[model samples]
Target chain A: METTALLRQLSEAVGPPGYEAPVAELIERLWRPYVDELRRDPLGNLIARRRGSGAEPRPVLLLAAHMDEIALLVSGYAEAYGHGYLRIEPIGGIDRRVLLGQRVWVHPRDGEPLPGLIATPPPHILSQSERKKVPPWDHLFIDPGLPIEQLEARVRIGDPITFRADYLELKNRRVAGKAFDNRVSVAVVTLALAALLERTHAWDIVAVATVQEEVGLYGATTAAYGVAPTAAVALDGTFARQHDVGEDEAVALDGGPAIGVGPNFHPYLVDRLKEVAEHHEIAHQIEAIPRGSGTDAWAIQVSREGIPTALLSVPMRYMHQPVELLSLRDVERAARLLTEFIADLRADERPVWEDEHGS
Target chain B: MDFELLHRLTTAFGPSGYEAAVRELIRKEVAPLVDEVEVTPLGTLIAHKKGSGPRLLLAAHMDEIGVIVSYVEDKGFLRFAPLGGIFPLYAIAQRVRFANGVEGVVAVERRKDESKPPALSEMYIDIGAPSREASPIRVGEPAVFVGETVRVGERIIGKTMDDRIGCYLLIDFLRRLRTSRFDLYVAFTSQEETTLSGARTAAFGIEPDMAVAVDVTLTGDTPKALPMAVELGKGPAIKVKDRGMVAHPRVRDAMVEAAEREGLPYQMEILTFGTTDAAAMQLARAGVPSGCLSIPCRHVHSPGEMVDVNDVERAVALLLALVA
Candidate 1:
């Protein structure tokens, strides 16, 4: 698939934290032919294992990217206009400011996907202090653009809703859409797997489209435990260059992927990946995560006994909001860097796992 | 009732992202009873018992809401961020102890007007260090409430009753369980107060047919509190919904059914603010039918968190009924 087309296809797929079947299915289809074995774990992590030609018990190198997106869901309703106006809360992390004037996808029970818009209460109707404050979730409601009675009948509490931001291929190959926070990471993993398929490596590669990562590093934690990989790398989106963000926190967009360095990342893995990025002249940034990276790498690093984990983050702009921006070059670069890193790995030359029991 | 065990668990130095001491205690307690036990990378303890039927995951986080040292000032006062859902209103004036045994008093950053409420960020921990050089605590270290469990007639009060109470129930259940119809996987999870990661991964690894998280729920029986139906001393709360999840219909029915079968008094939980390990468990894999058995707790996430012993015991019984 064309990178932009694939990006749009995955972004448009409605998969909240728990509701990831649509996204998982699309991943399964794209990932099936490239791997030796593929299956979905009990927690809905789509695990695709690309077998190696090495000796028996080939050590696994896992790459995880969460398929779930930050979206909203119906929480409850209050009666008004002879119908229940839907009160909603975010599924993952969403800035309330971005929700203003957003088109939303409401997955209602027993019907077609319903189109909804956040009701922007006019400024004239608001009190002085109320106008200054972005309304709390209690005060926010969605209008599905149906008749009051029909809206009430169509929607129910707990139904999943995603933002309806159409993916835009921007000038200079920058793309904008919702859920680039992770959907693009999946794209990178796909590109890496496709690249790996054309090469030979000694270590097994388990590309896991992990679930419920936006909620926490849930999917990565379990996949780490289940796969018990010798080493793992979580492909995720980091903060892209923005004037408001601190220099220490931001990664330059189009600068390949960020090689993570921090407590969460194994120093050995970090050095190895950094060396490879340098060797290949792959544009990369160094991201410091002194504590938990708030990515799957944090959870995966601490999974049963510990898997030496590294984080490769694509720089993204306007994260957690609709229309998150990304550069396709960074995605392709991360894929190539990871593929080359795996290709360079000798099955016997493992990550620093001897001290897994300690810190 | 093992008040001694409860006392130790409550007083143990275990905060989210740091659960070694708590895990050590739980390992020794349940190691003899469980068929297999292991610790996850995230520091959660998974103890399993074999059975012939479906896999059942029962989870209770061992982590408690605490604070992590974010920055240390020149005078040694530590600025901290909450490891979990902790309100600043209840935290001020409380004592906290770090993993390394350094104790500190929580003090709010001053406001020009004393009447205004301080946000959590506007709080600091004073360990009585004369200067930054004299301080024993380092930035990034975590500290939990310094309190001990006390039995006040039918009630027990302590810190972290929000989850240690649930852990106590699970531990007691593991020791008492004889034969079960389903395979049991009990995860003494970690980082729930912060990440809710332990239960989520444990559930996915076990691939349980159904899951239940045991935790503490807020009660409104206190004077002039919000109009919540859950009351302290009421039997286990069968969760219907919370901030994170709507219980699967079958899981909700199963709890109610078990409660009825055991003739145990149970409240229907509709928590407005807090979420539990069940919320993360339900999201694991394809999705497991999940619900919670909550012990009614008051002053939750505080040093004075209180739970009725009767409620705790009944919660155990209801869980047994579900298992059988």
Candidate 2:
């Protein structure tokens, strides 16, 4: 599948947290030919294990990107004027401020994902106090333009919903549309896995499209424990530099992947990823995460007695909202960095944190 | 099902960052019931009952929001940061208990004239030590709302009901199980009030096919409160959506189906504010379809939080039916 096209579909797919079957299935079909064996773990993690050329029991290098997206769900329904409207609640860390005017896809229980607008009452109908405040996000509702019974018959409560916007390719190789968090990194994982198929590496590679990272790196936790990789690299999106943000806190959009450094990351693994990025001349930034990366690295770092883990971040603008901005070049660089890191891994290598500040 | 257990669970000294006492209590009750148990470094207690392929993660958070000492004053007053979300208005004038059994009262800075409400920075915990050296609570020590689980008529009123009710329900669910149809992993998660982080690791390890959060949620049936559809004593709430997650359709339906099949009293929950472990559970590996069974409680996150005993019982029933 074309990377951009797959991203568009992945972005469009209505796989909310804990409900990533649709997106996982899509990735499975795309990755089936490249990987040796693929299985869905008990936690719904899509684990694609490719044994290394060296040996069957060789150390595993797991590359993970969460396949889930921040989304909405049907919380309650109301009917009036023979028309029914649905109230929604958010699935992940959402900027409720940005939810007021986005077109959305309401995944009904039995039909195709439907198109709707998150409609609100007119300013005239709302109270003065209500007008002054951003109405609580759970108070937001969707209007599917269907009558009461028709709407209820199709869209039941708890069905996952997502932003229904087309992925737009802008000038200068930039792309936008709900790329807010990890779908781009997921695409990067897909691209990297595709690129690795033609190459040989010493160690085994486990390319897992993890689930539920938006909630708290749960997919990576379970998948990492099950995969029991010797080393892991988590791919995620980071905040890009805005005009007001200090350069220290943000990365640039056109920059290559952001190589994360922090307590959650293994210093050695981070050093290796940075070395590979430098060796390959891939554009990248040194991102700092002093305490926690708030990524899958946090869980992967301590999985079942712990695994050495690193993070590759794509610089993204408007994170955790619809229509986030990032350059495709950044994604490609991240994928290349992952492929290079895996190829460079030596079977005899085992690195642990002796002291965070030391070698 | 014992009030004494609920009382002990509710009264256990644990804030978001300090959950040792709470975890120890839950471990004792849950150890004999499960085939395997593991405590993660982040302070989550996970008990597993292995069965079939599709895993089921049952979550109940152990930690509650409280004050953490940020500054110890010469006069022995303690300036603090809230470990989780603590409304300054509700927290002011409330007494708190530290993990080391020290007691204190949250006090707001006094102003010369009648003034607007103060911010958390203006407040201090008064622990009756004359100086910083004499004070038993030091910087970074956590203290929660003074432990008290009171039975006022038929309602259970106390602090930490926001999630101790959840912790209590998970234990009760484990003890009452007849047979496990799916592989069951019950996570007595920590730091849910802070980040929902512990459940993340436990869920990853358990990776159940479906999951449910047993937590307490806000009810709108109070006088002069926001008009919410949920009310105390209506029944256990099967979450539709909250700040963290939208319960998956199949899981939500299964909860509803279980309630209907068992003829259990239940309410459909659409929480406008606050979140639960379901938010973490739903996003755990490949995304196990997850939902929440909330015990409707009034005055959530307040010292005098209230939930009907019947609601707790029904929530246990609804969860049992969903997983079974």
Candidate 3:
């Protein structure tokens, strides 16, 4: 499958944290053909390994990308406007401002997922103060438009909910859809694995589609310890330049993936990535994460005896929302960079940490 | 109470993500004492003492609250974001030393209203550089409050004492502990001030039967302070509940029993706000029962956070008794 098509399918898949089966199944199917071994971990992380053409027990390069996206959990049932509604609480970092009037899916205990719409009172009916403010999460409810009896029977408390947004193609090879905050990076790992098939690499590749990263780095924490790769790189989304975001804090969408540097990222991996990007003429930006990257890289870095970890991010606008936008060119560039970096890794590679003076 | 060690730890620079220097100091201090020592990838220094019994993980964060340089203006004024809870009023006129040893003073942008104290967004660090190019500090650099640890009456006062004091308590406990029935894992965790990342991962790796976070907590004894039971200098505070966690009943009772058995003065803590490494440790895979032992602190999160030395000693004693 092409990058765009694969990402579209992955993005549209519903995989809220702890309940990532749908997306995990899709990934298992997509990765089975290319990988020599494919399986899911206890915590539901999808791991696929492609053997390298090196001596036995070749060094492993772990590529981590969380498959979970920001979603909602049905908290309770409420009735207003002569209709029954399901109240919600955020599963991750939901942008309350963009939540009103969104289409969503309510995953029930049985049967097909129920289609729902997020609704709030019309401005005319709301008090003067309410009109000027975004509705608090409690004030917003998912209108499945079912009667109280049916809504109560079908949707129980704590049922997982996900946003519903159509995949859109823009003028400049950009795509916008729901759950792209992560599916973009998952697609990057898939594409990279596909590209590495024709290349000669000394290091084995362990590509993981981690779960529960949106809630915390739960899957990455356990997966890294189980895999214990020689080194690792986490693929995630960074903020792209957009309104209200400063230039220093955001990267450009079409400019390519952002290679992260700072305390969380090992210096050697960062330098190697930059060198490879320059050599391959791959467009890339440098992202400085002062402390925590708030991604799987944070957990993977401290795994077991500490694996040297780096973060490569696809820049997207409007992250953690239904309509996250990104450039497909950037995704391809990120894949190429990863394939080249893995190809350049030596079987006997040893990590070198800079001294106190970083000399 | 090893005031010299407390002084050294409180003065060390180890903000949330940048814990290298502190980790090295601790690695050296505990290397000879423990059977094995390892610094986790995220910079947590975990020292293990072999035992045949159930594993007990004790976490004390080496990292402290600080600020990260977000943007450096052309005039050398650096805009920053707080790595942890930073009160603008507490920060103004304070000195901050960067990891590179470059010093800066905290100041606020002038506002027309002047009615309210400046928010962190309105605050900037003046590193005394004439231009951005001339400044030694760059964006993404971290800086902590520069304060001297000193003995004032019965109190140890300084910056980073909120956690370094906790580190000191753990170090003291490790030094004093002779033999234990429980396997001891002492973790000098990182990033507690920011994300509690260190404790969360350390507990997962160690998979301990139970854990306790040795850190400082607020006291209500101050004049006109919010009414609560904990008070400075009276005793070590045993956490019952905090904003982030309710101490696991088994662990909480164990601490109470240890304190009572040791005859060490202790207080039950119910903090209205704030949390510690114990909160994160308790949630680690399959759940590990966890609680916190707190040194009563006054003026928390300031350059001169004050902790009673007697309280520190008692907390260590209680911890040693628990492990025994």
Tens-digit lDDT track for model 3 on B1-324? 788887888888887867777887887889888999976656678999999999999999988888887778789998887877887889998999997888989998898879998887788899889998998987667899899999999988898888998888888888899878888899999778877878887887889999999888998988899998998899999999999999999999999999999899999999998999999899887899999989999899998899888998888889888888
lDDT of each: 0.84, 0.80, 0.88
Going through the candidates in order, their DockQ values are: 0.07, 0.03, 0.23
Q: Which residue pairs clash in candidate 2?
A: A18-B282, A44-B286, A178-A323, A212-B283, A219-B285, A222-B204, A256-A283, B55-B208, B55-B209
Each prediction's TM-score versus the true structure = 0.61, 0.54, 0.80
lDDT at residue B33 of model 1 (Cα atoms): 91
Q: Is the docking of candidate 3 incorrect, acceptable, medium or high quality?
A: incorrect
User: Which ten contiguous residues of candidate 2 chain A have the minimum total lDDT?
Assistant: A350-359
Candidate 1 residue lDDT tens string, A1-359: 47888898888887899889889999899888789899989999999999987998898999999999998889877667675467898878889977777898899867889888888689998899988988888878888766667777788889999898898989999999998879898998887788887899999999999999989878887888899988898999988878876443466889788887544666578789989889999888776554567899988876754567889999999999888899989888888899899998987876542223452
Over 4 Å off, model 2: A124-129, A353-359, B1-324
Expressed as tens digits, the lDDT of each residue in A103-184 for candidate 2 is 9888887878888998878899989999888878667888999998989889999998888878888898888888447888
In Å, residue A46's CA in model 2 sits off its true spot by 0.7
lDDT accuracy of residue A171 in candidate 1: 96
Residue A127 in candidate 3 has what lDDT? Answer: 89
**Can you tell me the CAPRI class of model 2?**
incorrect
Judge candidate 1 at residue B298 and give its lDDT.
Answer: 91
